[model samples]
Target: MKIFKERHFFRLVIVLLLVSMASCNKKKNSYTAVSELDKKTFASTQLIPDDHFLGDASCKTCHAKEHDYWQGSHHDKAMQVATDSTVLGNFNGIEYKSQGVKSRFYKEGSAYFVNTEGPDGKYHDYKIEYTFGVTPLQQYIVKFPNGRFQCLRTAWDTKKHKWFDLYPDFKVVHSEWLHWSRGGLNWNNMCADCHSTNVRKNYDEATHGYDTKYALINVNCEACHGPGKDHVEAARSLGKDYKGNGDLKMTSQTKPKALVDACARCHMRREQISEYYNFEGSMLDHYFPQLIVENVYYPDGQILDEDYVYGSFVQSKMYHNDVTCTNCHDPHSLKLKFEGNKLCAQCHVPETYDTPKHHFHPTGTESSKCINCHMAGRYYMGNDFRRDHSFRIPRPDQSLKYDTPNACVQCHKDKDNQWAWEAYVKLYGKPKHKHFSDLLAPGLRGEAGGLNHLLELAKDTIYPEIARASAVNVMTNYADPQVIDNLLHFLKDESPLVRGASLDVLGEINAADYVNYLLPLLEDEKRSVRVKAFFALGSLDEALIPEPYKAVYKKVKKEFETNLKVTSDFVGGKVKQGNYYLKQGKLLDAIASYEAALEIDNTNNIARTNLANLYYRNGDFANAEQAFKTIITQEPEYGQTYYSYGLLLAELNRVEDAIVQMELAIKYMPDNIRPYYNLSLLYDKANQLNKAESTALKGFKKSPQDESMLYILAYIYSKNNEVEKAKNIAKRLVDLYPNNSNYRAFYNQLNAVQ
Candidate 1:
């Protein structure tokens, strides 16, 4: 009976194996058939054929005049082969070194080759197959055949006349960021979308790679003007008759909004939704839509940062006056529509504004220019030169009070804001302009002058909505019943942002009487306003909210819950929920939510980083280390993660590992201060006295006023036996933190030692 059972079992196993093999084969065949069908379907609906991207030679067939204008524009040579005609820098085997790294740019007959310093501290010779950009900054491109064509991070140094490395040495340490074997230096993912025309980053989900190629690799006129294929064909088929029918020009004559849309595609720093390709469909569709002044300007409307395109243009009265792009710039040539003062003269009378009498400088001198006085500002890079586009008078009073930049001090580098203010007072003598500057002065000095301005600004329609939002700063200082009542009126403003701001300001009052007024705003049309209202409602007395409003709040809350449920299938919804939880300080809940999301979709690195941050914040060092390590392994190019991990490691008391991690962090996120501060502390603990002092000094130089950084510097100086320096720092710390007895005692001890 036992022998019979064993034989039966063996037969059963064999039958099961045979059935599994047949099922596997069937699935393989089915997958192949389905893939083929999908390919066919995709091909049928593809926007443009692979062969449709004809070179410039084919474009010159009919529209010779248009082609001639394009040649002079920056777009024509935006990218080209590194021939003598295109290559700007002296590439005669010139070697350049920067930050302890070296690179050599040389030409071999018709071809250009560069031995560049890779991220790993090794010099690699890559053949320059293509050159990108025409002015400001240009990059070299090289193809790896089976791999991808990568744009080298090192750009040609035009002034220095050599090629310079842009990345640090540690980036090449077998990390994902520097691995040339895996298509390392491809700018297609980072920058190609804005620079190219009809770019399609055909990313394959299965392969996890991009099959990127472009119709035109630079910002062509056709890119902004729409595809010139149809227009060109029409012009060729029928001469001047093609005017209104086929030729769609992106000019003042055509759809004016198209020009702004074209510029905004690249210029505005908004989030991108789709792959870098798909220009027609991939632009930023939705953004945080409150038109706050800070979103567009500094508090004083002065250009504070490198917000070049949007900030200046949006603030100009030109935008309000319906002045389109073509009014200032010629689309074909891309130069200013007129030369010198003529550009400004288009709007302002030259006799009144452009003369030396008005500018108060010698004619033909640099300071005599209208841009020099009205729009004088600096660009962000090493070169602190370049005027601003926002044409406004220099309010030297605001500049003196707030230390904001002014047009006068820009040219007269020898003079301070005080000098400029005195000069302006002598010239113009304090005009009573109804600008926000007049309002912010008193608020900045901790006075109540902002109250009256806030009241006036809330009523004025001419002032931007942003100026009214600035009133929140002054509201913290002095309470005015009139201001509060006016803000209440804005609770029902047509703009959701204004209503949201009003709700936020109402929280300061915490008044039971205004609870009824705030309750209805909880059901605002905008999601952001509703979210703000929910929090504001939490601040008010529960009894004050009527039963009807409570029901409305519950309904709105239910709608959000239902929407979250419906969209929870996608990663975006999970991310949104995680953000909401993070903002509300529910850190552990956010971590769990993000972790669950990653379990469903492992490719979600954003969730992984967010979970790591939560763990770091909660003091769960072990989990934070594991999470950061996992992310580092998957994506080493993300340097900020390494810095965060180093911070966590330091908290864990793993000093040596912390040092190594901090070094790596500094190697990537060089500008960050946390790693430097922690590194200095670790060095002091290890008795590396000189290193600690140097690191602390560096940290102090970066952030002199940071209390923790000051404390660290003081401690480092004391350890180095510099009693005087240490006492000075301790005194500063004591002054900053007068309530802290520990700091006071430390300061006393330092003074005694000194």
Candidate 2:
């Protein structure tokens, strides 16, 4: 039996279920009633004099129906004060143990307290300031000095009614930034913007603190419908002297795309651009949605991590077909409009879809469900089974070939992928080779036939923009002329995502080559496109850029810089700022930024590694060596760190030490080709022909089409008198790149020699 195994792609699954919890209430059309169980655990909306934020209470007086429906919703109880009524967990001096650490949850008088291992790696009695989220799981937020609220590692499983560790697989030490007590889990920076309305993350970069303020404690009507001040004023002037139509700045956006973008501000896996923004413009203006890439998503665009919904939904046919989050789900109550097959029948014809012929399962069985086949669920946070929003069809054939999860075998725990694939073929006939997954899988793996397939997928307007952009992103690693040409064309694509992704790819390439090409993008309509254009231009030599374009660059560059500043309190933002500075050739500023990131979260390995690389690049060998050593000692499993350290050692003329580090890098990341190529070259330079040949051949086994590895292997084989092997490699290389003069010349030379 081929049971599905979770990969190590997501180091930590921080599943923040932005949407409402699952509902069993069989409401047909009317809004799901909010009972006593549904009362929003957090504070409700109230009118404030100066502030634009009118709490749920303010709206309830007029829009009582919406208020009642939204009362006990996920947004309503996103976070609340840890009180007798609010605290869901058993805090009656109960002890929960995991990984040699014991935490006691107890209540003193009316206050909830937890005696747990803190940031200092010692047990401390920390007051539960707030209860963050309630559903399959509920986490407690503990306030620290420096105005930080961190979600505790241990969470209460609401469904199971038991305590469970968020990171059950590993014992995260207190000192690590990923530890519950650190800034990585800080509520103000990570969770507050989405959970609350009119949130201003007043993060002080100089003070290294947050004076974070929010209008409403929970996501109220104004959160989605935009600020209610103008709407409320318009309502108040209803019978007074109101004009033709009250110019209410409400986001009553009926357009499917616009409405989704409004919701995406919270639901998307994205980066913040502005401190506070209403639903007035594009989501790309205020936040940059992360492209569907590895670590964040499966190669087939499945939700590999806790990528809420928007990222996956944007790639689905549903989003492209004008279907949105509100189509199936109630906009206010955030529950399904119908139950089971009836929900699918809302749009799809019941006779055509919700039957055994369509579902290919026994009627009324769990496998017969529409969601089971189309929207497979994956368990995150121990018990939270979130469904994949991509809504892809069951493709067990793809699963068998690519080792990705398929809905067919997800429920059939005792069946192998081959069994599922054969059954699917028998029932549905051979699946069409039309899915974006077919192209994306090869593109992500860097396998043969990827270039043409990916290029076609990218240019095809029929496919989802997110999927097309993802294709462009994966094609970035390839140096094909068509790849660059297609990317250049995509720079002018109508979709902001495509343009932004193309710019990201071109920026990594020779930025000077596309300097004039990306100049017009500085004034691009989308903020994401404009910022990416600025980034691409910023990569070039300042003097090489035209005078007229420099002004455009400066204006957009300020926006980019301000975006970084707005999020500088977090480790990720600081690291990004450091990278930006590094690209700008400000080594000291880059170093300072990285150092600042470490100050905020001491266990930020990316910052540490980047700092080490900078030190090495700047010729500070001593510090670089120390930094690399610390990283290796602390995070030995991180292959990239070892690979970087190997390069540093090589530069220092410590070839033997470099070789060892490179070998370790290969051990951890076998699929990585850089270490193999570099290690082989090092071996050849050291006159170790046997080791060089072995290393190159191993790399060839993993990535047979890798031109660099093939060249090195051919060279080593020819020098070692393995003429036949050298000629075979030469022939393959020439066949792969027929037009390449170098490959042809090398092949001819090898043939002549033979």
Candidate 3:
């Protein structure tokens, strides 16, 4: 119960947010039909002109050599119709089983099909519509009603020549989000745009369905080179002597930034800000790249989860020094331009870097391999081992200090971090430069002086924009007046990534106060930035805005909704839509969106959490109670549930039950101040004077800045006849909130009692 009562872990719970949320009105379980909701995927094949696209066959006549390299590359085979030539998986009536689920693959005439559990939780014979990905492992896609394409969890290991479950350790039930039949596995919203050329996710809001369309079923010539119609027309009319440039300005000689942007459109793990990728602007103009953050990357920004190359590559000095994709890999073939140290020799001095004096290992060994030391990779998609493009020094010293992954220990599995650190020092000596990881690792961990260090990193343009953006994002975790000012100031930063990241933080914490500062960004050049601005000002009162800015606001709001519509087919999208509706006071719409999210996958507790909160707000406590109970059973360790349930119990006058829940909440959500603040009040209600006073004192010690908890402590002190203690707290409250008449009145009352 007295968790966080000692020293600060630096994980500050921003006050009792639940207490404010409980005051919201509650209603009966009335959900809007998914079709009836205004949300849409807004994906349409008609948005762009069909004539603009010239298929791969149209380019082969002039670019024969390049076309040959592209013909059977992973990009060319990224997606295809399920045919004898394209289908890689064994389909000779072979049975595959994993985690209580079983599936049988076989052929039905020319079509491939699998007998497996579907959305209905019963085994059905589903026809394979397409094959997704080609190397290492290949996934099969099955079509559902309303144009949905679901990737089966059971994938074919191309290397192994057998079927295996992608989620081997996971218990993938049909009703779960990660199930092959659920939204997480839906190809239209998740993987279609990247796999195919000119994909339109075309999700119809009225049907809860998809009409997903693509120009080509694979990543074609037009996918990276923009629409090839102009180039084709120019080439045909000009003949061999004609040297006129088509509007499509891409080649092997393309600059690092432009070329990287074209590839990163698909490669990077990002948020789409536009409905259709018309190949108009940079990647930032269409998609918001995810930053290096905890869980996805280590605190020091090495790959932990799937960063998809771009996020990691941008952090390297190679990218900053103007090395494009074509420098290391043949863009058309998607193969390494040179093997092993030869690739490093293309730019790096082979005589210097390729020697044992540098690597301290024998040549031709895996330990001496340049990539194994610098660009240590991780296995993804079960079997596809992809290298980290960051190309960093193997700093086992930093690994020892910050606990981040390093190639030294990564390869030397038998050795500890300490051993690696000592061996590295004996080889390279201590690093001279003050690495950003030294600052970022501690900052992300919430260690002392971390926030200030992060602020310095955010302001420094010398660091990678993505790294700076990460610094900008971390500022939101702390609460301070100075933090708000710093975030607002960062809104004008040159990097769109930093600017958008700052807008995200400002919009989240103080959107209303930032109306004037945020208005200019509604017309931001980058769509990702503009959309972030819209969401930040999402809770803003439109009527209060200046009339001159109203139309621009409306336009960005439309863009914002369009961005949301693109992802509306996923559970995360529905939850976002629900939040959008909730903010607009459309209670029924919010409830429907949440319900629809749950409908897609019943185990999405995030959707249920919002739904339960909505039910509690609407005064339909019965449904709220049930939803909370269901969530507890579904995910027992979710601390917010116990805390929220305790609030409802208090409202219901179940004092003893509420006390138990509050205590449990504190145990689970130790950093949170709400449970401690509320529990003190509950203890007083139960007439446990000693416990009430002690708990109040501990809570006060934990968060001296929280006035509400301080007020509770003052009340508890007064109730226990400690008038002087109560008077002192009341006086301090008056000083902190000088003009508050409530504090003044309470202080006078305490003084009189004293």
The C-alpha TM-scores of every prediction are: 0.58, 0.87, 0.87
Best by lDDT: 3
Q: Residue 638 error for model 2, in Å?
A: 3.8
Q: Any idea what lDDT model 3 has?
A: 0.78
What does the lDDT come to for candidate 1? 0.59
In order of lDDT, best first, we have 3, 2, 1
Query: Where does model 1 exceed 4 Å of error?
Result: 1-63, 81-84, 108-110, 142-153, 157-186, 202-208, 232-240, 246-249, 255-258, 274-298, 380-386, 436-461, 464-613, 616-621, 625-754
Write the residue-wise lDDT of candidate 3 on 1-754 in tens digits.
0001001110100000000001012211112122211213111111444566778888898889999999999999999899999998899999988888889999989999999999879999999998988888899999999999889888999988999877688686667666778766778777787888777778887787999887888988877776665556656666786464534545766788778876787777776677766644456656787787787788888987776789999999989999988898888999999888998898889889898888989988988889998898887667778888888887887777778889988878999999998987887789888767777877788776788989989988999899999998887666667888888899999999999989868765657777889988876767678888888877778887788778778767777787777766666667767777766678988888888877766776766877988998888899988998998998888789899889989999999999998998888888788888899999999999899988888788888888888899999999999999899899899999999999899889877762
- Pitting candidate 1 against candidate 3, the one with the higher lDDT is 3
Worst 10 residues of 1 by lDDT: 10-19
Off by over 4 Å in 3: 1-46, 541-544, 582-588, 667-674, 690-754
**Which lDDT value does model 3 have at 16?**
6
Runs of candidate 2 with Cα error greater than 4 angstroms are: 1-50, 240-253, 540-554, 666-677, 680-754
The clash numbers for all candidates, in the given order, read: 0, 4, 7
Per-residue alpha-carbon lDDT of candidate 1 for residues 290-348, written as tens digits (9 for 90 to 100)? 23234234556666544435445554566657666778877667678887778878988
> Which residue pairs clash within candidate 2?
38-72, 45-55, 45-56, 46-55
Better of 1 and 2 by lDDT: 2
